[model samples]
Target chain A: MSDKKTITFPVEATHVMMFRRSIGDYAVPDTGLEKAAVPPTFPRAVAQFDPDYHLRLKPGEAWFGSGKKPSGVEGKPSSAGGLHAEQHFEFLRPMVPGDVLSVTEHVGKTWEKESKRAGKLVFTERVQEFRDQKGELVCISRGVSVRTERPVDQK
Target chain B: MRLKASQISVGDTFEDILVEDLKRTQLVMYSGTSGDYNPLHTDDIYCREAAGYPGVFAHGMLTMGMTGRVVTDRFGAENVKKYGVRFTNQVWPGDDLKGKAVVDAIRQENGETLIDMTITTTNQKGDVVLSGYATARAEK
Candidate 1:
């Protein structure tokens, strides 16, 4: 089954400024970018508008298991502990303010592994592709989240 | 800053970046901006009592984002073709992270110049927190 969904949002300058400031890129030369161009890695801000944005907000939920209800997993706690294992990005074009991005995300991979501390670890990969208003590919992002069988405290 | 394709060699190096110290306010702003509100990153009480962490830590993406500046500052953002990273260690508040990107190879493919690079970010203790590679098109 394909767990695919599409999200659309305009790149806002205010959010871009906030992201730049948050990362401490304050010395960016004022090349009149307050109106158009955005900082590098700005496309990642799209997560703010995801409908399931709340899924990643909780600390108790496993980073991999967040978003899906605990009922989805059998013989395990509703929320487990996990980590953000990896991230990859491919940028095809520069993203600027006012450009509306249509992002589509779907499950990419699922696997298991044996670990000394966490016991067995389950990993889930999600890939998000962003296209411009003209349907031209702009960026591709892949995120890997791994969930453990037991909590950190239990380990 | 733009560099000609011919000017970049296997040993070429981009300017190193001294990242600002990780701060609590920066973590909160990142959570709000990136929508990654994991309590281990933003809430101190939850980190201590529930997560059993020393304290709130910066998001991995935040460190990645800061490390990326080394590339965008030298090659321009639009030039980036691929970037990937492996999280090696945690970044704590007050830690001063330093990032360096070195050219690993320069190849010509399909009439386009491609520059490959290896990136590493280390904290004040000289411990590597993140390491990865990136590929970008050269302006020349």
Candidate 2:
């Protein structure tokens, strides 16, 4: 299984504003962000533009009850129930509307451990690197997803 | 809006900012905007009946994003170099949250001054829903 994928898209002011509003930053005067400057965590919002950006595993099957389904890969675990365990970001440069960002994502470390509640827990980390139209690095994001078996009652 | 590394002491802390109460409508808005249609976040019935959650809850990203404002509002967003968080607790509807960012350390690296900060967000019940750390370039 190829452990990497890439996608590119343009940033839109409207979408950035929607994200601002979604987080209840209603008082941020539109004029203050005239440059289309996005918030610190805005890169995550832009990632949704990728067509393949969906949880790979089903909620009921993963241990934490949620997880990203690995794409174009076989032999991946199918069990469900997981949670978004952790998130990390490195913003190397600012992003603005009209800028096209090329994002490359690759699976990082994957391992398993024993947990009392879920029995065996599987953890996966995915890293995404974002570059701008000028080919300058913009941001790097890491997301950790953990999968575990659901309790018998929840199943 | 850049903060001078020398001007900010290691113990300096930003005043707590109250985030808007968590609302179902806001969760739905985030679901639509982020394109994360996880039934656990938007469908109460599915969350309660299928996922075993008491009810639909706000996305952890939503809480992180809101808490991030504490940093960006004090220091420019462009100055932020690193930000991260761990989801410690679920935020339910009607829960009011407050966030505060404290300067943990200030140091010079690669000829640039940087400030390290620890961020914490708590619900009205005083439960720490989310906690994280951040690093940003400081001016002066």
Candidate 3:
């Protein structure tokens, strides 16, 4: 649990509802917020609270998605922000809507390997701890992102 | 409904079709909800010209999120204590996905019953896209 940065995430009911739909889980009703059963991977939604998160669009900054040209940024980014390699979650207790979480992220591990499909691969692990308002750990998320020397061979 | 230790066995398996003919709009929906605006998942032109991919691909987290239902449905989300996965292959726009969760072990810890399971998600061609494991509480 190396110290790094923290952000506050307010778990809202409507947002949870939307996330459920995004993942195609329709069996559970979105009406009951208090007793609503949240999905196990909901913690990753913490990205919303991270103001400087690289993937989201900022108000005035040039976005990398698309516009008149293939990209809005001044120059090519060489590669995409890498690919997701692994993700894991550990829950100490069920995290429900209405619980404000204080989320913190720390750099975990980094390594490199040679790959035939994508050339050289550099992997970095980011660990996040979600804590309730009471300062109790609600969940722990570990994610690994990888950057390849070149685009993966489609064949 | 929570899995019952009395009713389930180590080899018992559960499966679900996570998605069929996956649409680009589905990828956009995931990007919107997940706050991940990575063009590799939604922007065709950017991916083709810049990233060098054929086109957009699904976020690994999106696939992980969908694969989770196979486990959560059986044990209930609240009962799950651990869930994790590795992205084995990329998922494309028109690909169909199916996920399976197989019970691997059941044990008693501190008088509480728990089940460990192995997870696998495969595309239409039988290529494994995601693989991982989960542990959840069971009714004693």
Candidate 4:
């Protein structure tokens, strides 16, 4: 736990523009947004800057997404990468598109539960902190992920 | 618009229609932006043939992200000190969503006024897809 991995996220205006469009926030125009703040959920885009983010497809690595088959990687379990359970963000200051953030994530907590439909559910929590170049804390994001024993029963 | 403590009261509420008939393309767009390319959110074939489900569903983050507009619009993104949500149900394409924030309390913290509110996003069926709370600094 001592050697925590940190990713360098250089916030770009184009990335913020695309993120705003993706979230369908038209009112908060990206134009001149460098002087303003991004969406409250803007910190979630740090995944794009994490080189080892497992959810994204990496070159030379087999992805779980379908190509010729239902899954490109063999024996990939259903409900791959787990499901997002909860997310919480605390911002000391708004994230600006022009700020370079030093992001670090570490495991927080783990627990297990039993569900009739999904069977055993293992929940893992991760905490990510975004710090500006000045090393000042900008934001803290906490996300919980649940891994189901099987696909959730669509009842 | 900034939330003013003097102009607001507990039990007051504000809301917005987050999306009408949520589209799969939006999910793809989110993945493109957020770097979450999990097939469960964008790959229908993977959802049907590989994973046992109806089809591709929207990412929970997408719902959270979309629902966030209401908060930022009301509180101003800079004023939002804390925002959080729990995914209650799966969001599917064509599902319409509405987000609401109810004023739970207004109090003084650190000599500054703050607003605590409850956040909820519901689908067309009245099913809550996301529920949580938010705290924002309010203008006194």
The candidate that achieves the highest lDDT relative to the unseen native structure: 3
Per-residue error (Å), model 3, residue B92: 0.8
**TM-score, every prediction:** 0.83, 0.83, 0.95, 0.95
Complex DockQ, candidate 4: 0.85
Task: Please report the TM-score between candidate 1 and the true structure.
Answer: 0.83
How many steric overlaps are in each model, in order? Answer: 0, 15, 0, 0
Measured with C-alpha atoms, the lDDT of residue B77 in candidate 3 is 82
Give the i-RMS of model 3 in Å.
1.0
i-RMSD of all predictions: 4.6, 5.3, 1.0, 0.9
The true-versus-predicted C-alpha distance at residue A144 of model 2, in Å, is 0.6
Docking class of 2: acceptable
How far out, in Å, is residue A105 in model 1?
0.5
lDDT of 4 by residue, B8-109 (tens): 899999999999988889999999998888899999999999988899999899999888888787777778899999999999999999999999999998
Q: Candidate 1 — which pairs collide?
A: none
* Between candidates 2 and 3, the lDDT winner: 3
Candidate 2: stretches off by over 4 Å: A31-33, A55-81, A114-119, A151-155, B1-6
Order the candidates by DockQ, highest first.
4, 3, 1, 2
What is the Å distance of residue B125 in model 3 from its true position? 0.3
Output the TM-score of candidate 2: 0.83
DockQ-derived CAPRI band for the predicted complex in model 1:
acceptable
Candidate 4 lDDT by residue in tens digits, A1-155: 11298888887877877888888887645574455557778888888877778888889999888899989988877878899999999989878778899988888999999999899999999999999999999999999999999999865
DockQ of each: 0.47, 0.43, 0.84, 0.85
